[model samples]
Target: MAGLKKKMTIPFARVPVAINEQKYVQEVLESGWLTTASKAAALEKKFARVVQAKYACAVNSGTAALHLGLEALGVKPGDRVFVPSMTFTASAEIIRYLQADPVFLDTEYGTNLITPGILEEAIALHPDVRFLIVVHYGGQAAPMVSDENQAGILEICNKYGIKVLEDAAHAFPARLGERMVGSLGDVTCFSFYANKPLTTGEGGMLTTRNKEIYDRVKKMRLHGIDHDVWDRFTENKPSWEYDVVEAGYKYNMPDVNAAIGLAQLEMAAEFRAERQRAAMFYYEHLGQLQEFMDLPVTRVPFSDHAWHLFPVVLKEKAPLGRNEFIKKMAMAGIGTSVHYKPLHRMTYYKNRYHLDAKSFPRAEKTWQGNVSLPIFPYMTPEELNYICKTIEKLLKY
Candidate 1:
């Protein structure tokens, strides 16, 4: 029940900081064809190549990418998908699109993905689980789905035929083994919002190695058109010849947005370097504050972190709780936020799923105290130091 010992103001996130984004937008302005056409196609190819996915389909938002991924992977109205309680609602919300239910799985205190043990337990108990949705919260990789566990989960899912979808919205360039995030799970998703590692203002991509899933998602990303709309009118093709294979949402990413994404993607290396640098600075500096906070643990041995957000958990300390600490930081001009209130605890999810607040102790405690401090590619080192110093001064009582 205490406050930040004083006042200061720091931003949480600022948009479009990628090095080559602006020039790309200008080039797109002159490219003539705009909407989900040429630029979008090229971006999809570049995105697939970079992420190492056999196929990639650009869409309007991370949520759209998720929805399309689910649809293509055969999510149905009566299906039950196991999802982490600790992720953004977008991860769970897509399940509702299929009239399917999200069976909220708890997260470990140190990272966002659902536990392999609890997942095994859940799979055993719920024979109806048709899919597993793993969210690598704040750019951290999902805990490995070991061969044994994979066989277990996949066996059960395969018995009833279930698919695994990974919500990699934050874990963009993260790796697992020799594969990148987008290629890790059955289908993985990435975001390009104004605030992501790569920003297209508002866009996302869904990736998969499975030909059927990828092809279907590609169609679903558009209006479920049997073929690419851009190709439908290309050269000598008749404009009126197209088929609505199956009704789908208008989630396609436009060429202009792809133009921005193309530019941002080109600079992914530099962008990734800076974000990791910012995280390392935060980790090196903030890790010393163990008396006050806990840093997220990385599972990837040589896995590259996209370092999307530097979420630190405040340990039990003198005179301050999580919410109070956030208020104090805000008062001091340092912007901060809790990554999420566990999805199960939200009114709609609770009412629908009958999810009790106390069901996920780890995720609950994590959400209650987790503070995502400002970490971005554009943040100056001095700014980061100022934040650490500011928090240091504040913890004094």
Candidate 2:
């Protein structure tokens, strides 16, 4: 302890500012059309093209995108939505918003995603379930393209008339062959939160191949307006009059946010590569600690990971518990986080649905020891080395 140097603090996550972010923001400021105008429409088109979707609707938040996706699928009260327990609250909360029930499923230990077996069981248990919110957990995709009799997960869902709504919040540029996550699902939602692969401070996009679903999401995203204000203002024959098609929420992304997203989109590929590099650094260094922890898996067949968050699971034989390990890391100026607590363990969901921790064995087991290390596009090589060394030292001690 006598010769120990002070350790500089490392943050768990950081947003990478695109080269043109400031320029785009400044342009939006000068244009004077801030609320879901030309910028939003342009972003939508570009984003849709990037994800290989027919349409994309920009919204205020990822939660809003999920909510509208449910609306687009016509989820009604008492309808049951099959969801994995190992996800963020938004994935389940949106089901409640529609007055629907969420039938939670267990996660697969290896992938930390819902598998075909889980799907089959859930379907048998709740035959009337109409929707499935498959989250691309940690940017590693769910079994969208599986080798099952019904084809893949998407096809399986189709067999049951269950609409597959992808919660692609962590997966922006993730792909399975030529088809992207957004294009595979009936509707897909993406987040542009500060810590996401792409950032707009706070924004999201809802994409779909169905024209009807696309049109409905577009209208519902903006107070059910028959047409967006951008159309009227930019047209040669401009008129202020508009009709409200239905009661809808006020969930439109402003131009300021869209401008940032546009700039971020331009550098999406670069951002993904940088994140992947950082993840590889973690994998290479941390694999040595396999006796104590399960390092994040990089190679999953038929898929390309977005490398959103590098999560490692501490084995049962670990010397210290997850929280204690985190405390030690914190003291050493190394930041760490848990990807999620199983949603069923949350008080509200447990009380509402009568869930027991014993039921979701895989989710609970994974949640107990999971830790997400600092991973971002901007992480320097020195930072990566420091984190790796710190973890190795802690494990040895």
Candidate 3:
């Protein structure tokens, strides 16, 4: 490998930025209100308008958003939700938080979605599935829960009073037919981590159409207080009088983060377009390799794809195993990772759910062979060259 040219690096993600993001964050810092977290409310409003979510509430993280979505949907203990086995741990962990059980359903062979057929089969076996938690893996829209596929999955859920909670950490502005991802389901959530399409450094938002759910989420987000806050030490506010109606968690976003998000939201279209451009470049250059790896969906062939992850599943006969390939890339200074390792593989869930990898074959396939490549909105051309060179070296033409 000595004569080989030194390869430039490709980062897995390059956070998008707007011209005004820095200025806005500085303004928030100068304002001196660092912690009360009102920017979360403003960001909520911005989120509602941007994604067309009827209501939006900010939280500390994506995991917190999932938990709040669960609580807002009234998912109580003993409830059983159907979740695809191929997803981030938060998708199932939130269910566990409520003392609820999550039944794992494998994803479709060619798609990241949990097809209605699998869901229908699983539902038929366990008539008690109280919640349908569909995960939209890698920023693509979740499979449409239309009545056509499972005959009456939603209708049956309605009859049984089951709820729908979508885990859309990767999906930002993901579209389902005519509606946005946040608008497609009963409750939707999005992350604004550094790697997400929108970045608030570390923040998330929970959204819904139900006003009642919004009301509860709003009050619960900042502790069950009925008033504004204790910081206003000015004249109009009372000296010391507050009402603690019920218990709540301190999962609100700070103004600094919201300022970043507020500015980032305005640049969403540009960010999305850049992401699309990068996806096109990768596809045009690498798509012929379908003989080597399963390429990402060109369009979902039905609706738009947000392209949050450029995940390529290795063919069984590929030159290297997924782990081996990742090792090679990392050593070459190209970062890579499996989107997930089957939540069943985690010690916590494995012990808690008594999950055996052998029981779910498809999930194991993902665990064994799926690898995500760096597809960022801002990957430099030189960096792209190195990423491509590294892959070309590892694969059989």
Candidate 4:
């Protein structure tokens, strides 16, 4: 066994800055026009090309992207949307933003992802549901299209006329078979939050093939202004003469943040590869402890996954509970976190919808033991070894 080194702190996540991040930001700084200009436009073009989408709109956050995408998809007041019980608050909260209700569904046990069967069952109960927000949980793409033997979420939703909005917040640069996530759903949203697979400090993107949806989101992202700042400023027309098509939110990504995004986008493939390396290390080191804990499960190859998180669910027979295990790991200088407590268990959702623990059996079970360990790009062998050894010591009774 490797000796546990004292005071060697490993954060749950660390953004790996790309070589061009500084250079691009410097160029943006020198350009004088910094707010939502050429850099942001460049990012949108490059991002769309990379994801194989017809159009891409860069926004300030993933939540903003969701809000805009839902609005564009005609999600109106009193509508019901299907969301997974095991995701960040942003997934369900966006539904509420449109004055719509979320019908939270239980996820698959190990993946914490809402499967095609779950979606079909929910649709059976709520036949009026026309919208669905499919979260690509922890960087694994949910089964969107049907296969030879079974119908997928997209196939099932299409039958019921459900508009699918993919929350690809943790799944940038991920693929489902040959198609990347951004191009798979009706509208796809990606987060560039500090700790995500790609980071622009605080930024996001929305991509879609429908020209109407694309135009709606593009106009609405910046206070419903028909003309973007770049267009107004660059064109020969008057910069001040823009029309407000509708009352919209201010969710445009700035040139500075977009500058960062450009650099990060360039290194996205490299970053994903490094993350996969770390995941492989964890599997090799901790595979023996499967009896005591459950590691993340994915249907696709590990290389296809974004590898944003490597969570483990401690079994009933483990030496310690989830909280205790986290504390011990912290004491050993390793940082850990819980991906979520599930929206069904949250006080607001529970009180509003009268949710019951029995309603979400898989999510409930997974939540009890969920602990997301440190996984990031460029993690050293020593760091990986320390994390694995610590888990072994804690779990091996």
lDDT of all predictions, in order shown?
0.79, 0.86, 0.76, 0.92
Pairs in steric clash, model 3: 139-170
lDDT per residue (tens digit) for residues 1-397 in model 2:
1222336678898788888888988998999988889889899999999999998999989999999999889999999899999889999999999999999999977567888888998889888887899999888778787562446788788789998899999998898766887898779999998889888899999999999999899889888988878877777545677899999889999999999999999999988888888988887888889999987654353237888888889888888889988988888788889888888989999998999999889888888899989988878888898888877777876
**Per-model TM-score on C-alpha atoms:** 0.92, 0.96, 0.91, 0.98
Best by lDDT: 4
Order of candidates by lDDT, top first? 4, 2, 1, 3
Q: Which stretches of candidate 2 lie over 4 Å from their true place?
A: 1-6, 148-150, 298-303
How much does candidate 2 score in TM-score? 0.96
**Model 2 root-mean-square deviation:** 1.8
| Best of the two (1, 2) by lDDT | 2
Residues 188-274, candidate 1: write the lDDT tens digits. Answer: 888888888888889999988899988888777777888876878775678778889888679988878998888888778777777
TM-score of 1: 0.92
- Candidate 3 structure quality by residue, lDDT tens digits, 1-397: 3233445666677776687788877877897877645566677887888777898878888888888888888888898888887888889988988898988887765556776567767877889777888778888775564644453334455656768887778888677666788877678888888888888999898989999887777677778665546233433577586677868778788888888888888887777777776777777677767777777664353226677888888888788889888888877878887787777788887888898888677777766678888877777767766776667667764
When superposed on Cα atoms, how far off is each prediction in RMSD?
2.6, 1.8, 2.7, 1.4
Order the candidates by TM-score, highest first.
4, 2, 1, 3
